[model samples]
Target: MNAADAWKLACGNLSNSESWWEKVIQAYQEPCRHYHNVAFLDRKFKLLDELGTASDMNAVILAIIFQYYEYDPQDRASTNNLAHFQEFASTNDLPQGLRSKVEALLTGNEDDLEKNANGENDVQLLQDLDMSFLGLVSDAFLDIIKLERKEYDFMSDEAYNAMRRKALQTFLLIPNIFLTNVCRDRFEAQARANIEAEVQSLGK
Candidate 1:
């Protein structure tokens, strides 16, 4: 599904707001964005549909919608996006509990991952969906890397490769890249192979 269609699926009985929807669409359409655009959301929504295991699909979809709301290459922490999402949630009258859950998922810290391993199904599914790209076939994975690199075009090749290598290494260090059982079974080996290959190439 496209971002708009995914939003409708997520909203369900809730009234859809054209202005808010447009704001989200515009944010993803921003010139600097490449990998984190509407197409990324579409992939995530497809994964969510395939997984079909989130306890709170609404919260997962909401997190996907706003996770990179205003992505900035310099802002590795995504603090601005989180703040903007909080405001959006408040203004849209989202239930407090759902809002909090989406915030936690967006943060995606070690604590959140830990919680997901400890039975937080919704968080696990969302996190796994966000990371599903890492497990794509080599050509597809490299295609995403090319787009992601464009997002950081300001960085010199050496600097960007170093940063990319570190990020990929961090994932390799993790025992299991994908949290959910289904994701692990489907993606773990391929994800490791892809990351290892990219890390080696970055070194060259």
Candidate 2:
């Protein structure tokens, strides 16, 4: 499988984020870009303790976070998209409600995964959720932000801005997931503030 496929499926559980995806690639000539992207995220989980709410995550909420990761960040252009998107969905057999959303997203054959799709229904998922998990999630976010394709060498300002804008749109979705009370109170606000600041600083 390719680096993207390996990243989505291998990150079945939170711990899987730390797995060696480079070894699984067919073209294992250099650093598997996708693997390092994820590993960079895995390393970010260390901050959970600072929030004083590190050990709170139940398996599913944690699973939600993990499952959320597996879903492709790319949009669906056709039917086989489900087959492709499934590679990114959580391996744990998603919750019925969440599964319904996945099916809907797939069946509708939409372009990109939107904010409300996963953001709306957040209950005890956060009560059980912890700082470490958020740390990991944020790390994942950072890794994604740092993702630089070998293709995008130093180039024109317009070219760089276009890529940055697309990435910023994706990054904007994370705060929606953290809308739950604990996440909002502890991390979401700070994350948003930081994102905004960074977004403002991008070409300066």
Candidate 3:
């Protein structure tokens, strides 16, 4: 199914007010999002379903739903996206605990995630949910990264290499990319291989 249809399915599953999901859909349609658009969300949900990491259905849905709400596809800034999600949660009277977890995943900070490791299952599931996109088929991963790279082609080779090296560093720093055991088992080696290939390509 397309992004709109998949989003409708997610909204139906969440049982949230139509207006809220509508706002989310509109936010995703914003012009700046080449990679993190509806298709991205759809792939994430599909992975969650396929890998069985969707333990807390509502949180999983919300986590994925609010992922890009404050995103400025052009600038790649998420400050507003994060704020808007919190506002939406508060306005909807969602539990603070649940909202917190969703926010953590949206924040996507390695240090923050490590510190917030109190709820092991929930946190792992959320991590796995987000990382699932990285576990896509090799060509798919390259395609998405290429799409992201298109925006940066004007950069000097040195600058681009710096960005690529930073990406490789990030992959090395993560202890385990996929959090859920099943996903970890399925994609861990593949993730490593993909990183290695990218690192080699960058000659870093």
Candidate 4:
């Protein structure tokens, strides 16, 4: 479905925050966003359905909400959105347990996959689902990163290639790219291949 539908399903009784949700959705829809858009959120939702903790309703709900928490293009650094999410959660009367988990995930460093992959709970599953999209849509995702560089006017081929290589290298260095067994089986090989190919191409 669309962002509106996703918001309804994920946000539940937080219907009063329609304006906040709209602002978030619009941020993802920003013209500069090529990949981290509503479509990305939809993909994460699909993955959550497929591999998330469906048994725990709270887990599933939290996973869906976390996917969009920092997906907004405006929050490129993801700093502001964390506070926004906590406030939104508090106002919506989310339980302390779930709210704490959300805070942990948001406060954790985005680049520290190992640090974030602390537990096998729904939060970890949510993190996996978020990263899984990058593997699944490797080429397109990389293209989006490149597009973002262009938007900022990278200035030269060297600068752009350096940025691209750094991103690829970081992914390659990750110990376990996919957290779930099913996702790892489905994507590891192809993702590695794509990343390796991109890294190789950077020199050409």
Q: Against the true structure, whose TM-score is highest?
A: 1
What tens digits encode model 2's per-residue C-alpha lDDT throughout 1-204? Answer: 223433454344534344424332322233434433444334333232233342222322233233223222243132253443354345444455555455443344233323333342322332323232332345554554556433244456577766766665576775463644445655665566556655676753
1 against 4, candidate with superior lDDT = 1
Residue ranges of candidate 3 with Cα displaced over 4 Å:
1-16, 73-78, 95-120, 151-157, 173-175
lDDT of 4 by residue, 68-136 (tens): 455434345654666767777777777776666556565553232233233444445666666674565
**Residue 118 of candidate 2: its Cα lDDT?**
38
Among these predictions, the greatest lDDT belongs to 1
Q: Mind sharing the TM-score for model 1?
A: 0.88
Q: What C-alpha RMSD separates each model from the true structure?
A: 2.8, 9.6, 4.4, 4.7
Error of 3 at 193 (Å): 1.2
Candidate 4 regions with alpha-carbon error over 4 angstroms: 1-3, 54-78, 109-119, 137-155
Model 4: residue 31 alpha-carbon error in angstroms: 3.0
Checking candidate 3 for backbone clashes, the offending pairs are 32-73, 32-74, 70-81
RMSD of 2: 9.6
Ranking by lDDT: 1, 3, 4, 2
User: What order do candidates take by TM-score, descending?
Assistant: 1, 3, 4, 2
Query: Between the candidate structures 1 and 3, which one is better when assessed by lDDT?
Result: 1
lDDT of 3 at 103: 77
Local accuracy of candidate 3 as per-residue lDDT tens digits, 1-204: 444554555445444557787887787767666776777777777766675545455555676777666664346653566777777776667777667667776676334443323334655776676666566678987998787676465677788888877977798798988766777888788778777778888875
